[model samples]
Target: MSFFSVKGLSKHFGGLVANNSIDLDVEKGEIRGVIGPNGAGKTTFFNVVSGFYTPTSGTVEFKGKVISGLHSSKIAKLGAVRTFQRAALFPEFTVLENVIIARHLNADTSLLNAIFRHNTKAEAGNLARSKEIIEFLGLKDEQDNLALNLSHGHQRVLGVAMALATEPELLMLDEPVAGMNSSEKAVMVGLIKKIRDTWGITVLLVEHDMKTVMSLCDKITVLDFGEKLAEGLPEEIINNDKVIEAYLGADDIVA
Candidate 1:
């Protein structure tokens, strides 16, 4: 079985069918990209797979376990975590503090342990892990800075760091390189590759930037109007006639 699989997934809001029987399979330790034009249900697919929305029909399975209809927090605890298109951070907190707080998802500290200060060892471990993640994402210099004080690009990176703090087996990134200059985009792409290579985590990303998606993903899935349009290697996806026709002049796919 694939490391992650979605079968016949669909989501509907009254008469608007946002997703229509979509199927996707991602292998372990691979970087997979999902792309589509605006309102194509790409984010909706991510939402369903990451448990932000229960599918109207069908199933999402991870490591052979069914995860459909599960709550977002429950799915996260099972090792699938997602980052938002907009960076989510504790704006008033330092970068280190933000990540440390995220690490609490995996800490499993009991209230009694916390009251007796018996969780000091776990707190120290979380700190060490947070620092390592900060350095891994090239945010070591910004560790002591308040999240709101960081540049937009850095804020995005911090969002990723927080996701990593969860120690997820599958990391789902929602437009991790959006709204960045070329340099910032390059840094994020490299960090994503490092996350997969160094940590052996599987990555599934939804992105609109064709260049970034093509360069980073091992395989690509194309969506159009809430349905699967195409799926293949980057070279094949770029050349697909249907994909071109669907997104031509509407998106930057050809370029």
Candidate 2:
């Protein structure tokens, strides 16, 4: 079985069907990209697969375990975690502090342990992990700076660091390079590759930046009107006539 699989997935809101019979398979340690035009239900697919929204009909399996209908937190605890398009951070907190807080998701401290200071060891471990993640994302210099003080690109990278603090096996990134300048996008693309290559995390990416997606993903899935329109290697996806007509403008596909 694929490391992550979505079968016959569908989601609806009132009369609108946001997703219809979508199927996907992602192998272990692969970087998979999902792309489409706006309102094509790409984010909706991510929401459902990540447990932010329950599928109206269908199943999502991770490592052969059914995850459909599970709560978002439950799915996260099972090792699949997702980052949002917008950077979610504690704006008032330092970059390191923000990641340490996120690490609490994996920390094993109880109220009593905290109240009596028995959680010191766990806190220390979390702090170490947070620092490692910050350095991994090239944010070591900004570790002591408040999250709001970082540049927009740094803030987005910080968001990824926070997610990594949870030690997720499958990381779902939504528009990881959104709003980034060319340099920032390059840094993020490298970080993502490192996350998969160095850390062995499987990535499911939803991105609009064609260049980034094409370069980073091992395989690409194209969606249109809430359905799977095409799936192939980047070269094939870029050339598929339907994909070109539906989403990737003729001028947008690089040779």
Candidate 2 C-alpha lDDT tens digits along 25-118: 9999999999988889989998999999989999999999999999998898899999998999999989988887777755555534433446
Clashing pairs in 2: none
Q: Per-residue CA lDDT of candidate 1, range 38-145, in tens? A: 889988998999889889999999999999999998899999999998998999989998888787755575434433446577766766888999998999999999
Off by over 4 Å in 1: 110-119, 248-255
Q: Once superposed on the true structure, which residue ranges of model 2 sit more than 4 Å away at CA?
A: 110-119, 250-255
Listed in order, each prediction's TM-score against the native is 0.95, 0.94
RMSD of each: 2.2, 2.4
Q: What lDDT does candidate 2 reach at residue 63?
A: 95
